[model samples]
Target: MRARPGALQVGSFRGVPIRVHVSLLVALPLLALSFGGALQQAAETADVPPGALSGHPWAWGLAVAVGLFLSVLLHEMAHTLYALRHGGEVHGITLMIVGGVSELAEVPKRPRDEAVMALVGPLTSLGLAAFLGALTWLVHGLGMFQVQFALFTLAMLNAVLGGFNLLPAFPMDGGRIVRAALTPRLGLLRATRVAAGLGRMFAVLFGVWGLVTLNPFTLVVAFFVLMGAEGESRQVRMKALLERVNVEALMTPRMVGVDLDLSMQDAHWALRHEHVSMLPVTSAGRPVGRVTWAAAQAVPEAQRGGYVVRDAMEDGVVADLREDGWAALRRMAEARVPMAAVVDEEGLLAGTLDWNDIQRGMARAEEAERQRSGPGWPRERTA
Candidate 1:
């Protein structure tokens, strides 16, 4: 599980790196304060002796906040461990302000396998709640009121976490479960559409409820769910469209290349005159990297004459001419680049591909699909 940009790597477990998102910094203290105040009130109601707990209520609240996140980590770990056991690869787990995400490198192809994988996370959380609840009984017997109270609070929170995750929300385990359940009857694409639609419906309901209750966290969660559902739906549709397409079919052939030693001023002129947004930078007649028009504009006018294409070029994705479009798109996504350089068998540049190519390909594919397939298939979104 690899963390995305803007997250801090805190530690690793069983070979999986754990990352904390920046938003957690803002959310943690607020959670601590809320939990602390609740704990104080509960303690007073229970008539616990003053000597029973020694620290400030906020200190204990902070401990509960940490414990809650740890439970979330365990919940994600359950998913990772199960996936690894069943021959699936996990990128890593990321802990964000809302909850945790277990990034599986590739989703399991089998519906049964996926359903079980999705079910295990919430099951693990519920199990944690049960174990903690039992531990609280032991603490109460030993007359450790503080320990008992903390354990009880954590148990209730774990129960809530487990229950909340069981709701059908796309890209969440519950939504995955729903998709898996429908895949046998509807096929993967249709099952994904149905599941994602249900998730969006749930998101709408949550958003309305949040507005009615004036809960900002609920509103944020609703927005997250809505975006996740829409994103998954688009990804599945794109994967279907590009699965059989190849790089050669979509790439711009006979594209021009710029020399690495070309002055930035000249490169900028070529970019404008050639009507291209980016150019492949070549070294010794071989594609090395790429420079964008934006990169050219970053250099000051006075320095453009002194700087070379090599000075502004960044790493470019290279794709094989025969590579399937889906795989090439995955590479581009991972590289965080909008375009890729395509090479033939002899390792010579054949062409270049960018978002324009993808958009055109998608349009053609959708047209072809409409002619051959039945109605109700998801339509491609405009680029």
Candidate 2:
């Protein structure tokens, strides 16, 4: 999970870290309102004393909200455990209002692997539903109607959650299963297109249904579904381009370090000629800062010829020699830096991994993928 500023790290489960997303704060109260209403209605139906609803309906609402998300956490864990066993690395899991997400470094390598991982989440939900159903039954027989009502509500919620997630939409388990089954025959991009297309269709249908029924919850879910499916398609395409690449292959070994005496005009020429936005500034082979276009332009144009690159540069771009290129892209994208100073184990400047480098690598990989394919089929990773 990508931890934003102020995000709380709860703990780790079997080395898979879990964190609470900020949105969970908003989701909790909303869930409390919805579930609280249901609980109050159940009390009225069961003819429980008015005190149950009147005394502490908020408490009941809070319990349902917390309990509901606990089940969602388990659903994500099932995916985390299964993914780790299948040549994938678990970055972490995150709990949010909509549900949980299992952050994996890579997609599964095989169709069977994808199918298994996708199927496990829904199966976990169904299993929980069955257990809770049994508990609800036992409590009912013991004349603990209040406990039974709570248990029954949870059981039904799980059943609904499991069923709802089974909708064949991209970014959902059933959609993944559909893509997995299709990947063997159709190429990956084609299969992905089919799945994503179906997902968008369903999203529209779900949105329309939500509107017709005046259910804002369903409409919100449909919006996420649509965005999720669209986002996953882009993710797959980017992964395809990045999968075969290593950072070392893309890094420029010649570090163009501009000294403190190198004029801003000289540095500007270097930046333009090299097609790079930033260059490492060094003094006597020791690092000082980085000369960025923004930084260089900040210097008065009239005095640019006199001002040195060091006068305008700033620091903080760094990457390791053997880091995965995709990982590097993510780090760079997050930092919003155009280039990184590639460093060796001893912390010496080794090379530079720049945005231009990534684009070139992506272009080469995409070209190679195209060249290796025949006329009818899309380019694919060879089996």
- Model number with the top lDDT: 1
- Cα lDDT tens digits, model 1, 207-321, are 9999999977788778878888998888878887888789899888845588889999988998898798898887765678999999999999889999999889999999888
Cα misplacement distance, residue 5 of candidate 1 (Å): 5.1
TM-score of 1: 0.85
CA lDDT, every prediction?
0.83, 0.77
What are the models' TM-scores? 0.85, 0.73
Query: Candidate 1: where is the Cα deviation over 4 Å?
Result: 1-6, 13-17, 40-54, 85-87, 261-266, 275-277, 283-285, 293-312, 378-383
Segments in model 2 whose C-alpha atoms lie over 4 Å from true places: 1-7, 42-55, 243-254, 258-351, 354-383
Model 2 lDDT per residue over 1-383, tens place? 24444447799888977888887888788878876777657666544545544346667888888988888888889999888776677777888767777877667778889888989999999988999988876766565767876787778778877887777778678888888888888757677877888789888988999999997777877787788789888777776667568777788885557776899988887878877677887766655668887777777778889887766788656777777787777676555566777777766777888877888888887777677775643466433
Q: Where does the lowest 10-residue lDDT sum fall in candidate 1?
A: 374-383
